[model samples]
Target chain A: MRITELFDNGEFVVTAEVGPPKGISADHVVEEAKTYLSGITAVNVTDNQSSVMRMGSLPACVALKNAGLTPILQLTCRDRNRIALQSELLGAAMLGIDNILCLTGDHTKMGDHPGAKPVFDLDSVSLLHTACQLEKGVDLAGNPLVGEAPKFAKGAVVSPCSDSVDAQLAKMERKVMAGAEYFQTQAVFDSEKFIQFMEKAKQFGKPVQLGVIIPKSAGMAKFMNKNVAGVHVPQWMIDELAADKEKAKAGITGVELAAKVIKECRPYCQGLHIMALGWEAKVPELLKQAGI
Target chain B: MLITELKNKDTILSLVSGKVFIINCHGCKDIHFPEQEAEALQKELAAGGNVTGIFTTDYICNPENLKLRLGYHAEAIAQADMILVFSCGVGVQTVAAAYEDKKVCAACDTYALPGYQGVTPLEHDCKQCGECFLNLTGGICPLTACSKSLVNGQCGGAKDGKCEVDPDMECGWERIMRRLAQVGRLDALKCPVQVRNYATDDEVKSK
Candidate 1:
């Protein structure tokens, strides 16, 4: 089902992130998704996440769809120029891929190949505009397509936990205009801040999914707090994770913490976008623990 | 003004060999020239007897004037094995274009400057992106200042009022929000999404 239609049906949709491997085979990801992501709404295939080289999201999404799972193809502008971006969008459409999440992507400097030339010819907003153009049976140059044009249930990202949110709101407005049907925010750690963001964001009249990253360890939480943008690992969360570490140190250590955050934010958002990052097996347990 | 920061001394010195001709542009009305830094490097190179000579000029981006000044340094430049350019990217480019055969090394890295064109003393920069967003952003140019160059809005990477890309750099959107709030025009941001027109940039347009 299209992500937009899921929201329209008033479903509390849940999606989990899956990165394609560095090599060509999508077998591992497809197997992982089939095993654990059956309960989720869709599989979000990342496009070279963290600027690391990986199997393309287009192929992986196709693989997931063939495996009887929905896929949201994350399309970033970091690697491709405008020409490739437009071409890729059409290619995704031709492959029966409809859901897309447009992003600026992490800078190439953060990737494995820091020296690779970053091609951000179009930013996220412009890319969304370009996508909308393609859906209208034309490209960015106003040139007509060969036959039937592609349509997408487009998504964009936002950072709700930013110190300053006014600028984000302004940008979110632009994303909507540029054809963002839904928004999945950056990793959210503080629920109170997210609630406040939701108050303002609700006016847009679009479904927003809260981004979730389970704090695997206290050190990881601290690292995210220090390095990740719009993500603040409150002292309480860190302390709790550290306490969990003090215990058995096994079987989803962050489930309670994840559940707490999910329970708080679930009321405000339409869904959850859990970025499992190799911990796909834990997502179902987390959802159940959160009483979803 | 084009603000140029000195590259690592050891790295710059490695590229330089034999008797070198130093062309330093005390440019930008000398408002931001790292004169002391440049002089310190020159002293070290001279102590080793590798410096053949030193030539000082301003506004090296001005090609016609720079061509005339090049005549004065021709003898010294001819004797040197390498030419060390202590200026922004524009100055280095001008010198490099003038002397294609001569190996020219840039002693400094230019930061957040517009074309490195050596224009005014003003701190702000405009890349001439054609479509202006200054009105909505309270005079701050997201294209030039924001590390991500996100015209639509601020990214989620800023922390402690600093940019996600560079910790030392101030978050561009934070500055814009402050300015907008200060001017009592914060509501001006309730506008539409900004889609940058790549048509103005020929390089981008071709792609």
Candidate 2:
């Protein structure tokens, strides 16, 4: 079933993202998707996330679809121009891939290949609007296409932890106007902030899936807290994870924390989008513990 | 007005091994221009050999003004083997245009000063993507400020409203958010502006 249907059908939607392999070997990509297929409404395949070179998200999404799991092809504008972007969208439609998540992507300087020139021909907002135009049998310039237009269950991302809620909501309204059927926010660690964000976002009357990251250890949490943007890990949560020196105990605490966030945010959000951050094996465990 | 730092003294000195004349633009009087670089170069050049002349001016970009100045030092400039220009790219180009026979080189490496190309440098830089979103981002240019250059929202590398690439630098979006909130224009961030025209630079260059 399509992700939009899952959201519209009144089932609490659950989505998870999977990073494409950096190399050609993607046998593990499929295996990773299978690990939590039963627990997720759909799986998102990231496109060159963090500006790192990786196996294309398109083929990975195809692989996931073949594995009997719904795949949301993650597309970014950091590497492609409008022509290439539209061509890939048509390709996804041909492959029976119906879901997509639009992102502007990080600059190439942030990746292993800092020398690569970034082609941000279209930002996330523009890309979403372009996708909507392609769905209507026209191009971004409003020119008619020769063939049939593509169809997609379009999705976008938002940052609930932005410094100003009004500004963030304004961006959210643009995404919705651009035809973003749903939203999966950046990793949110604070439930109070997310609840407040939801209160404003709900006025748009769209399904928003809160992002939850399951940090492996206190050190990892601290690293994300200090470095990652749009994410904040409360000192109390860090102290809890750092309470123990045992790695196993830290991992357990991490799960408990993710569960706590999920339980707290579930009341306000339409669903949870679990970002395992390479800890894919723990996603199912988190779902079970959160009683989802 | 942009930042132009002098190249290594030894490296520059080695490039012009004969009689040298220096031309520096004090017109913009930009803080990032390293106002003393021309004098330092003059002193170092004098130590090596005869320093022909130091032509100082405000509008180095004005070809007419530069030509007028060159007329005054025609003899000194004629004797020099190379002319070193200390200014921004526009000034360097103007100086190069004034002399066709002489080897004109930039003694300073020109860079985009943070913010607009105006006199005073701010904490922001605009890539000049053409479609101005400053009205939306509270006058901050996310295209050049954010390490990721994310337009719709902030990246995952922000911590406590600071950029992940540099902890000391406040996140551009965070600053934009705060400013937008203060002005009650936070709603401007909602409507996604049209796709950025990458050809803006090309069009300007062609003109």
The true-versus-predicted C-alpha distance at residue A46 of model 2, in Å, is 1.0
Question: Could you tell me how far off, in angstroms, the CA of residue B118 lies in candidate 1 after the best superposition?
Answer: 3.9
Candidate 2 residue-wise lDDT, B39-88, digit = tens: 86688677766778888877677777778878989999989976777766
DockQ of candidate 1 relative to the true structure: 0.35
Candidate 1 local Cα displacement, residue B168, angstroms: 0.6
Write down the worst ten-residue block by lDDT for model 2 chain B: B119-128
Please, what are the lDDT tens digits per residue for candidate 1 over residues B1-207? 446666678768766767899989886753367789889988988899878889898877677777899798788889997778887656665665566555566776554434445454334455545344554555556777787777666666678788866799998878767766764556656665565665644347335
- TM-scores, all candidates, are 0.74, 0.71
Residues A89-115, candidate 2: write the lDDT tens digits.
989998999899998787687888989
lDDT scores for all predictions? 0.81, 0.76
- Collision pairs in model 2: A170-B190, A228-B156, A228-B157, A228-B158, A229-B156, A229-B157, A229-B158, B27-B58, B115-B124
TM-score, chain B, predicted structure 2: 0.54
Per-model clash counts, in order, read 1, 9
Maximum-lDDT candidate: 1
